[model samples]
Target: MRVSGSGAGSMWLQLLLSLAALWLSDANEPGTAMTTRDINQQTRESISDYTVKGHDLSTSGSHLTTQDFKQQTEENISNLTSAVYSISIDGFSSAPVEENVILYSPANIALLCSLTGTSTDSATVNVTWKKDNERVESSNVTINETKNVLSTQYTLTIRDRNQMGNYTCVFKSDQEVKATFNLQVPQIEGKEHHVVSYVGDSVVLVCKSLKYTPINWIWYMSNGSDQVAVNDSLMPDKYIVDEKYANITKLKIMKISEKDDRSYWCQAVFKLGESKGKVSLKVLTYMTPLKPFLAIAAEVIILVAIIFLYEIYSKKKQMHAGTISCFFK
Candidate 1:
């Protein structure tokens, strides 16, 4: 208890310095490590969050691309399914009196007929649409005019077989113009239109119109470049026209000859127009089938004759050798 003033002061300073050193050591150990750990944890959490956000963005982009592709594919399919079939002509040129259009299936198809014209002077035009020479009530007529050119369009929707016929467009202005489109089902054909037969045998030539019933069936034989009407009255015994059904026609050719090998045309006359089909007839002789067999037989006979000649020559040579040997002995 009885100490000097300087000694006590020095001891107090040392005690303060030791406490300072202890505080500095504690501050540099666990406190600094805790701060560094907190910073590293935050950095790892931020990197994970960024990775998840990037994945979500990529997924959203892919979904949008897929949706756009599907929409475009649907639009393309719609365009192909709703395609329209059409025919066009001009008013100035001479339209054919009859033009055949073959339709396989006449359902869910819209046919557009267009006629364009050019005029020097402005004039009022009257247009009419007809089906099989009768006025069409459901026909849609649209007229467009640009500059001196005029275009008339008519639309007809074919739903069934009955809607197929001749469609005519008539324009009555300074002059009369007519354009006709003959729509018909495809012609019914057999597997083979060619027929082979022998002379003196009967052959039947057939033509069929499965969907349409013709008003009359006419047979025409090709005569050079011209078609000559086949009349049973002229050659009753030679040619016969047998029409048992309205859709079928058969021409029975009796006693076929070399002259019968020609093209025969069958004309089916309908209310709208006429359609023709051809059947070629080839007449052959009975000897034509035997020509190959005769050739084979001739070859066999020649071979046998050669063998017989060789055997006879060998026997004659052996007999001559024996005679010479006996005379020498």
Candidate 2:
């Protein structure tokens, strides 16, 4: 279904009302969808359904599904006609991949795959990947009577890079059962959010998107997924929102104190993906901790040195005056 909006205020009101009615009537209930642009955003504010309960892991964002895994498992029989594949970043691969595959940046071309055929009791399979029809990476795997399924991982990071196009993964068997998957590369965009904090209190980090741009923002901890608050009462005073550029996000601290000095994060969402930035706050103090003792010591040294210098000068003046008087006599 398509949704469009116009400049009229009454039209927006009517649209909201209709959306609410439609959400109440959906089969999966009110808050089940994992999209940002659903028409009934007012009714689906919280993500309670998406939260985990004990050991139950929900596969919401992962591209593969439980049914997909089961189908792949079933396809692998005595003949071993199926393969399971995955791709990721550096140091995460089980085996060595080529250097060009490792050094590929976002400015390069999209990842591609090619398949070839051979017939024997055992077959040697060479898989090649390319960008713009030019070969970039190639790997070889063998399949025989004893082995059927070949599982390999190619470590490559692809997100918000300069390259944009459709990526493909191809698998060819000794027989004619070949499989392919089309993966569209994601694009990158800049996003910024505003956060305010205060001392002896709570703070809400507002991840505001660029004005008139469509993006999704999520707040979470560094080690875990607990959603941090962006409201005022949780932070301390003496905190100032560092509003530098138009993209500057501020943290308002209330009742500034030592407890408020900690690591805080701001995650900005873009159409391509998400990126995070961090800030550290140190509470301000009136004077240095050892300043009082150091100040007294400095004053005593200054007084003694001034007295010693004055005595030396007075003696020298007395000698000079006596010499002058004696010469006249």
Candidate 3:
């Protein structure tokens, strides 16, 4: 009777244990827990929401595993580089828990790339140019590991006039990731010319260019080889230009004389160029023969009238003297 009771208890216990095992096995099925993909998707959605609001989403995209977080962050870095912008690791994933950023003027250089995905606090970034395939420059930054993000800025100045190229940034955190961009400057061109006239006469020698470019204008006369007249006010031998829409330059002959019959030139100076033009001058010429002929005629008339008057006076004097003598006798 004792053995049968013991057997029956054992059987009951075994059946109960079997039933418990089945229940536990059902609970431990393979598809029961949420997958890494699901967590990553959720993190990305949440991160997107935070980014739209201009809020710090760097810490919001924390996935279940560090690998997923790092992978997502690297992908985001690639996208940011394509858009010419940078994103905090918090906006990407919650892995490594540390971040670094590089600010570049050219923004698309190798140094910028090396700085990406790494802590900015104590890392050296290598720089290179695509055309030259040569090393350009490098930089270092200090960063905190636990911090979700860190950043540094770099400015580039162009010193060469002929240098032409785009700037690129290569971001490198602990991972090997990168981004790129382009830079450009303006080109300049210029020229100048002028027209000039003498004083007391209206002149229209200078015509400014139609292109409204900023420039400096000057009026001058080219007297000799490489010689220019620079007097703004009229001098004894110089001409002053009047400020008018016509850009009239005048050469004043206070007393116009034969010496005033020289060519007057006008010169203009612009920002990056210069030019000059001259106008021929002529003095009022007098009739050489007419003046001398008139003078001779006047002299001959005066002499004839004088002679007639002298004879008349002498005859009257003689007659008076004779009459007086006769009376006296």
Candidate 4:
């Protein structure tokens, strides 16, 4: 599904023209108030003749979960990859499958799991999602349009260990169901660690979460706005995130600045949930190194000055006593 020749040229030209036309429309409008219908008309006119050669514009697959796009590779839409996905059948499964998820203790995070079956056969395919051997209602799951390949998504917003285990997506067409994905969020090992570093120095904050299998590692300041993830968009010389292994990811701050003195969190993203650790950064100002030495020198000088004054006072007292003795004699 590679685009070449006149088709590619036309597509590129149409894209550029559409962008330029939109920019002009916005620029020409005084109040920047283009109605929805007007904008729709403009878009229609911009690509009236534009067309793709081989792709069918009307066909669509699934209602892509956020994870799907995250997992999809950047390839031409025309090229189709082989269907190598797994589905976990409940008690009926012949063998055990491993689908373990590690969840971090945080709010507003969700777990997305999908069961898909792809076949070229004419037999219609369907899938049902179940938790602990009981049939789950459609309200709890999202089912995609059925065709040659059928898929369903199960999302868990609230995680409770008591209610977890043996969740499965049973496919109707497959006799031997695929693999397994466990739903337990493993516990994070060890305790919170404290790291201290100075300005002009580099420090790496290590984060080892449950089960070492992390899809993403995010670092953010503990300011109430810490929800946004830290990435290369931050100053390239200052912040970096490196993953040493499946369970270990570290946040390295380079050439620390005064603003770097703040609380940071290392959040690990997984299919089941997120796990995180806290790091406290204390950046010493440039003058901090000199304070100790300066204090010691000041103390010695003060002591020497006091000793000199006492010696002078003692000699004066002796001389006065001898003068009084001579006068009396």
Candidate 5:
């Protein structure tokens, strides 16, 4: 078999071209090679039928169902809203001495307290309510026992200033456990808590309450980090406690010195607890406000003296020049 070289070369070239044509046909065929968009579309379709724990995924691939997500959101919002008006206390020991303080403003606000008992026997557990250590008679309290757990709830309404006091929840069982809620009015703060006065000047620090008439008014001065009670008997010439009215109390600081420049606290003792307001006293010399004017006046005097000296020097030079011209003539 004697084949020519040109014919063999031509046959090899035709075979290569035929193989390339077959590859190109297969690449263009439908569903043989997928574009990026086609692959993403198929992936989305397959994910739509997927399930986990018998719960179908949403169209957007979110695992939570519509109703479940909505209910969870509502429950979270409800919990946050109720937390503002309710207070919960639990885990009481045999000897409970810590008191929780709750401050309320001058408004008709109702406070809800939920108390849980730690006793195993719910049958022998009893709860009682007291205000300032006196028995409270009200129909707004409820007690429930479920699954050997004893719980009680008390609702107190503050309609007037006199109703603010210490509320105690006493749990009686094999041992008595008590928890106190010291309910008091918030301390009234004035527009200016700072008072500026000169040294050796008598200044009065005042604290007043419009709604509450405290049982007693006491004044304290800050000594370093501790508050020492201001006793008129001890420092008779310095401090004088005066009550202008039933609600207004004044502490007159006679001959206030630089050492008296500190925070003074005025505490109003009520039946429930004590509320204290802070008043800061700032002592300065009488020349403190005039310091800026004094600096300006000194600068003006120095400048005027400089201008006057320059004028005198100019006049002396002119007289010397006239005498030299006459000598030259």
Candidate 6:
């Protein structure tokens, strides 16, 4: 039967919704969809001295944080002071107090400097921020004090080299306490992200670092569906071999396909832990209109719907002969 007027529009709307739902359902099917997210974020945050060479892990004014940084600063100062307090008492007197101890992490990209202090008597301490021995009246500096714990943090724009310098955190009470850190933007390492390739074209993804080298490479599709062990042994024309005295791990995907359009990770397995780089492939267009499974599903659904509608029409036709009326509603 021909669909017309409001009824036809309503049916079309429902059909579109159904098709959308079916497309979403395919996301759950094995080997169908790649997880669409910022795969650049490392899942394993459990890091040792984070290292990021040339990129900021976050946007402007966002600082990597640590809870109880004051306590850590105190402990660090105490440890260092205990070892050489007697010898350097006169020479290191101007050294800033352990206001805050922000351990540099190369894995995370962010410019962070902090100050922390504690007072058991009242629950707060007077504090001030500074950079290059000047008073820090800039609104960009953020200060927060909780009960007896006080924390002050400052973050710079990603890769903003001029903004990086000696930052000093000062705490004042009956005595003046100061801490200073010379934060600088260092030369970076590792492949940032995104190497595009078209269908039937080959691509190479490189993952390396200056400080360390990987023992082995583990390759996995970001969607979590396929994980192939990378080795020199030939497998379907894809291969990975140790390059540059086992410093760099390179993966070559031959004759890429639309299915290859997703983020791929090359995890460098080191003795201590692992580090990875996220590389994505972009397929220009598909050789065929729709994937095999989606095409088959659409045909099957169309046939089933036509058969159902025919059965309903036949039943209504028979009922009408007996003076019965029927409607879709």
lDDT of each: 0.74, 0.44, 0.45, 0.62, 0.74, 0.56
Taking the tens digit of each residue's C-alpha lDDT, what string does model 4 give over 11-61? Answer: 999999999999899879898877889889987765453422322333377
Decoy 3 TM-score against native: 0.24
Q: What is the lDDT of residue 94 in candidate 6?
A: 40
Clashing residue pairs in all predictions, respectively, total: 0, 33, 33, 9, 0, 14
Segments of candidate 4 deviating more than 4 angstroms: 1-184, 224-228, 285-290
| Lowest-sum lDDT 10-residue window in model 3 | 98-107
TM-scores of the models, in the order given: 0.44, 0.29, 0.24, 0.44, 0.43, 0.32
Worst 10 residues of 1 by lDDT: 104-113
Cα lDDT over the full model 5: 0.74
Model 5 lDDT, residue 238, Cα: 91
Root-mean-square deviation of every model:
28.9, 20.9, 29.4, 18.5, 25.9, 36.8
**Residue 22 in model 2: shift from native, Å?**
37
lDDT of 5 by residue, 103-165 (tens): 543333344444454645666667888888898878977777665456566754344558777
Candidate of highest TM-score: 1
Model 1 lDDT tens row, 101-182: 6654433344455446556343577767788899766637766667665556666545455788888767667776676777
For model 3, how does the per-residue alpha-carbon lDDT over 1-329 read when each residue is reduced to its tens digit?
35688899999999999999986786688776566898899899988987776565454555235577689866655553222233243321233222222221112222222233444444443323231233345343222334423443333332232333433333343443333333322111222332333434433333332333223345454455554564555473444454454333334334445555555554544322344545565544456447788899899999999999999999999999999999999
Superior candidate under lDDT, 3 versus 4? 4
Colliding pairs, model 5? none
Error of 6 at 151 (Å): 16
